[model samples]
Target: MRILIHDYPGYAFPVELARALAHRGHVVCHVHFSATIGPKGTLARMPDDPETLEFLAIGISGTYRKYSLLHRFLQERAYARRLEQAVRAFSPEVVISNAQPDIQARLLATCQDMGIPLVHWLQDLYSTAIGNILKRKCWLLGALAGAWYRHVEKRLISGCAQVVCISDAFASEMKDWGIPDSHVVRIDNWAPLADIPVMDQDNPWSGQYGLAGVDVVLYAGTLGWKHNPALLENLALALKERPKTRLVVASEGLGASWLAERKVEQGLDNLVLLPYQPEESFAAMLASAKVLLAILEPDASAYSAPSKILSYLCAGRPVVVSFPPENHSAQLLSGARAGIVCSSGDDAGFIAAVKDLLDKPENAADLAINGRMYAERHFRIDEIVCAFERVLNHA
Candidate 1:
């Protein structure tokens, strides 16, 4: 089968899936938006990559204006046109669309016109997330935009040949949206386990970043509107007394910028802010951490499941996640005994969890072991690829 996997964010595991499918004798063309601002995967083709696997980075003229609503909308439309051209050029038998509802909706129309089966690789509920964020920022405009987005998203979901949901929570949402259970398939998100191996704390990447002798609580992903950056600020303030302990955040975007300003204003020398590290340094960066942190606002908990937590687990590090209890991430951490799971608003509990991990090395080690073990057991690429194959072939 010739498959075109369009993952807008270029996440690690999706690239891994492309490789796996290619290895299984399918010709795969994996595409991502190059101008997106976030931690990306191994977007370039490696020497060991299969001959049938091709990676393409489709990009716009300038940086993606994520916060500028009008500019961002124009950019998204431009990106969709470029994406459509790429799709027409490849003309694969099956298309798996991930992230970016607006872009995916455009692609859906193209696929229908071309008589190609397009699978919706549902990662996040963009409409709900946008609604929550916008409503908080501006009520009337937010409601109007939110409703428009919701309508578009519902059409996209229903129009797709298949929907691959990342969590069971999403399946419930699908049901509420009047999507048939037969149209939805639950395939949990995962990390590239092989790519993110467990590395030593004193590795070259850590040394280069001056993380050699520090007790680091790190958050290394997109800190966007769906997240509460204040939690990170509070965590940094809480760790002020411990000179050796550092709050390292490796990210870019509005939330990161806010944190940067807060770091300076509060004189938080203990807060170390860095842009997203290169793909090669990712594992080592995670290794340098005593505890990994992830956050999701209560509003986002229903729709967005942070894939960073999976990478944190793959790095063999204890994780401290702040999200709602019912979130798949929280449930996964709780069930796997990976680390501590605190509610989004529980700043004190989150602080205590991080401190506990830092203070009790033995307990942290145990949690790290459990997390890695769970990843090893469940994140088998062959199994995941087979599951994807079933859906793609059927579609």
Candidate 2:
């Protein structure tokens, strides 16, 4: 099979998918566009491969142009020519897109022209009805981008030959959008638990970063709009009385200033922010931590998903989720007995839950084992990648 995967959550998903497909004797090609092309934007290099899969990335600079009537027209014209030509030349047997609506629509149309199957990997729900209502009040340019995103999103999903949604809740919303049941399949995010290293005394991060002789609760990922920093601040303040416990947040280029402001205002001495570390260092931090903190914005009830949950589980650390129960994140954590799931805005409950783990380190270890068992049984990267391979082959 000749597979082409569009970039969605950066190189992580694509790299996992590509490696799996290649191992199964399939030729894979991964294509991604530069997320940020200017000084304000940072670029991540897609590593090189000599065989099996070819990786192509393009850097383009244009904010979502919802309000700027002129910019919207320009984007439509530019992508129409550039992307159409690229898809035509790649001529993949199955074109799997990361659901950036317009690009998906173009690939669907182009593949239809060439008699190829088009698959849209639906990672999140972005609708005019919901996302627009929430973020519509952005600055003049941002507002424009918001409106443009709504339009492109609708057209793209509606045209795909198939949709690979990450959860049942997400699939249900796709049905609401008029995507046919036959065209959708549920495939959750996955990680290689086996790939994570075990913690030992000699590890660099074991006793470093103020983690030595402290009760460390780690949150590792992008600290963006999806994460409620206010909750983190509150958690920090609540833990201030626990002199030995520290909340260390490690991420890069995600609302750092916002976190800093809340930390200052709340006077959270236990809250520490660190820049992103390399993959090994990150794994070390996760393994060394006594507990993992997984957070979701209070408003993320529309879709129950978070990519970071599996990563935490794979690290074999007990999780403390700040999300609502009926939501997917909470359900997954509770089902695995991985950790405690706290109600949104339940400061008392959150505090009590953390205290329970701190007071019962043995129970915390058991919870962490449950999480690792779940990851090995269900969320293993090899299992998920193999499932994705079947999707591509059958497409």
lDDT of 2 by residue, 1-395 (tens): 88877663343545667766766777776766544211111113335433676666654456635334467446645654566676777777888877445556666778888898888887765543245334535556555665777667756777777789888888887887787888888997766555564564235685667577778877777665566666677778888999988888876544556777778887877988887666546568788688888777666656447767877888888888888777777888899999999987787787778888988989998998898888889856667877787777667
State the lDDT at 66 in candidate 2. 37
Show model 2 residue runs off by greater than 4 Å: 34-50, 61-86, 128-154, 206-208, 264-267
Question: Candidates' lDDT values, in order?
Answer: 0.91, 0.70
For model 1, give the 10-residue run with minimal summed lDDT: 36-45
- In model 2, pairs of residues that clash are 64-145, 66-144, 66-145, 67-144
My TM-score estimates for the predictions, one after another, are 0.98, 0.83
Best by TM-score: 1
Report model 2's TM-score to 2 decimal places. 0.83
Estimate candidate 2's alpha-carbon lDDT, on a 0 to 1 scale: 0.70
